[model samples]
Target: MRWSIPRSDAVDVLREQLRKQVRAPFAATAGMVVLLWASLTPSLMPRTALFQALLTALCMLAGYGAGALAGWLVRSCGGRLAGRARVIAWRVLAGVAGIGTLIVLGLSLRWENEVRDLVGVDRVGIWHLVLTVLITAVLLALLLGLSRGIRALGRSIGRFVGRFLPAAASTVIGGLIAAVLIYELAIGVGGNRLLGALDSSFATINQEFRTEIPAPTTPELTASPASSQAWEDLGRQGRVFIASAPTAADIGEFTQEPAQQPVRAYVGAGHEGVDIREEASAAVTELDALGGFDRAVINVVTGTGRGWVNENQAQALEFMWGGDTATVSLQYSYLPSWMSFVLDRQRAQDAGLALFDAVYGRWLEIPEAERPLLVVSGESLGSFGGEAAFSGAQDLATRTDGALFVGPTADNRLWSRFTEEREPGTPQVLPILDDGEIVRFADQPEQWDLPGAWEGTRIGYLQHANDPITWWSPSLALECPDWLEEERGRDVSPNVRWIPGVTMLQLGVDQFSANSVPQGQGHQFGTAPVYAWAEILPPPGWSDERTDELAVVIGDRAWLR
Candidate 1:
């Protein structure tokens, strides 16, 4: 029983098994081509070699599947390569794959260095490239093995069913059964369990209060002793926001003038019995209690999934207005922004509509001339939800005094409409809708200075050209975007090109690293909001000089954060 095959025989058998697992010559060639394309494409942010390897592997797998399906169809229709021809085909493909991989790896290293230099990250070396290849090979082997295992199971089922039915019918039935099983395992049961676990984990995270962020003692902030909302009930981000409000003294020091205490009202999703609509109503009530309606300016801010209001956006408004402002927001989900963007989008829409409608309804009750200047603002996923409250540019102008939406997602309805209808000569990155009469897009501070008399309520969208949140789309898999077709953004690499499936994977991966770069690039807005607000809702004596001074202050403060 302990006796076994000789060592050489075992090695030979293992080698033969591995050789059999290799895909067909044509399919392998197709995968090599896709791998080269994916590795060579420019990314929005500087990607580590590990991420690049993963992206290339996934794209190669897709190409291999497509090529294999094509080969199967051809053979089924009575096409075949003879023995000598098949051997020659394999030889040619081997040469092509080897040469192509070397060339692509070299080019990828250069491109990666270029992007790293642009974003101020360290350049990768030969070791990273070696790691990339090793990881790619390992990932490809695992993925291919899994797929082949599934195929083998299907074939076995087909053989059993063939006993009772025609060969073709049995094969079809077996495939359908396999597909159903995969769906049930991967999505129906597994997906629900995974989501449930994530929800519970994030919910627990929301309940935790960090020692660094203490409850606000000021009457002007929510969850204070003078406020209606309980301190324990505010979620983690809500507590941070409430504690981060600029006091009257803080604003006065910056403005060099007397200032009022800024009003900040927030409602957390951690409240047990409060629905979103009720939370919205409670937020308005908190704001009213703090005399928010009496302020010179009022901003209804739509927060990201976990209710994170941007400090840059909020503080810019407060400082510029001498703390004569009120900012209000409500938490809607416990998930992080990206997960909520994919899974809880409908909740975001509902939260945005509810909060805005509730606040707007109450604002209308005041006499038109006596009401505070109303405006709306959001960033990233928050921008996606914020846009849901408005139909288009005209709805924005009519409903509010001003707006500043930063890093808008690709699915933002109003943003897409404006970009689509932009003036013919303008590029997609900085589109000018209706000749910048109302809504306008800006990347730099100076782009706000468009010609003609800027009239009515000003609405500005601050989007960085390299921000994947603003550029990623499902359409990227099949079609080229205008941003890539036109001149590249100031920060984006000129080498960036559109490769059907490869570009989509590049951008999708880019999102994970978007915020790691310096401000004014990727998804970070930095002091751009200071410049945008100066245009959107400038103070009585606001000037370019003042905006410049404030930008410096904001930049300095951001470094501390």
Candidate 2:
């Protein structure tokens, strides 16, 4: 029922197809135009020349493919300009693309400087722009060459198959086969190997110590002289966490009153043959030994992938409660937060649920009146894990005295639900849910103060407007988020425009530099926890001035570790 090409004719057809595969000059010009537009688009953070080059090159490649496909479709539909008209069209497009690219580059430099000013970073010079152009040219050439090679291979397969089948059938079948082979080789096997290599490398790094961070000697800290957990057993981050706790002296000096030593218990992921539940149990044992349950406040904190608890969050509560606090955490993975967010997110959820349940069960054993105020906290991927332990806002409010989740990832179900159901007229960045009765979101310290009488179990989410961790979603490739459509956040550039797939790429690259900016912008939450905790559950007689003073103190000493 199907006609197949003869072997000799198929060879000739293949040659013609390969020859015609060469992209028209107009296609490159179209790509250049799109590349310029992508370069000028505003991002969450001010990018370095290297990052700018990468962004532009990637967008240019996408544009080139699109333009080439459009040309192919036009030709297939029997559309063609005459010799003189084609030449004129090419010249006009070339002129427009060239002039447009130069103008956009000039505008991009100004926009970059503006972003730097907003984020309090140093500005880039004209050299940066020059470097971006050079690097982009190199990257674009390499990408185009690779793309052409892949296309050629696919076409060759189709041509070979055309000797035995119809042209359309051959092409379709060849494309499908090539796609499957590429996916299997590149992702199924190569991706797994790459992840394994990265995991091994990061695991090695987790065992090493920072030059500045020595193991703790205090009895109240885990991995100390009197502790059951060994110093060598604690991973790098766990060691840093134990060593960075505020001492009685540090808290006493700030409060101008005698302070108790804060209890800190951490279980590392590096322990051999131990599951998450056992790790959590060991943490509870350490907490019990350190008299954590006897403290005025107990924080069941979730650490990021490398077991990094924000010192600001931990020390803020210590200083606020005059060191009468206990904080416990467990490491889930050796890979950094970003890597674990993609590969090992389920481990984080398991760790959070196990640790919180273990601690909550112990707390329940004590008399209701004698129980300390239990609070839950985490940041970024940590927040994603922490939210998994609870079903929704009601579960969080009922189970814990208060909670402060900072820079929550877009995957956090409770956070997404709250943001989606936020009151009308409220912005997505700083949503006011249920009139701030139980749960609230804030971009700054001052936004915590809501009107009317505050009720039970206050929960707060500290999110920056430019925090890519909180805003990035897969849906970004197709749909514009409400945050971009509404009145922009104070830190976000007004020039930011969402361009379907291009905006997704922009935000994807933005994640790398999220924490490179100053404390208030991007993913950095400097001194925000001090105010967040103050509003959630301030100590007796706590005042705005006191919160201000503590913020200053913590800002000075928090990053010492």
lDDT for 79 in candidate 2 is: 83
Tens-digit lDDT track of model 1 for 267-350: 998746337888899999999998899999999999998888999999999999999999999998888999888766777778
lDDT of 2 by residue, 306-424 (tens): 88999999998999999899999998888899998887688788988999999999999999999999999999988889888899889998899999999999989899999999999
How displaced is residue 78 in candidate 2, in Å? 2.6
Global lDDT scores for all candidate models: 0.85, 0.87
Clashes of 1: 0
Superposition error at 156 for model 2 (Å): 3.4
Which sections of candidate 1 miss by over 4 Å? 1-17, 22-25, 156-177, 271-274, 558-561
Predict model 2's lDDT versus the native: 0.87
- Score residue 73 of candidate 1 by CA lDDT: 74
Top-scoring candidate (lDDT) = 2
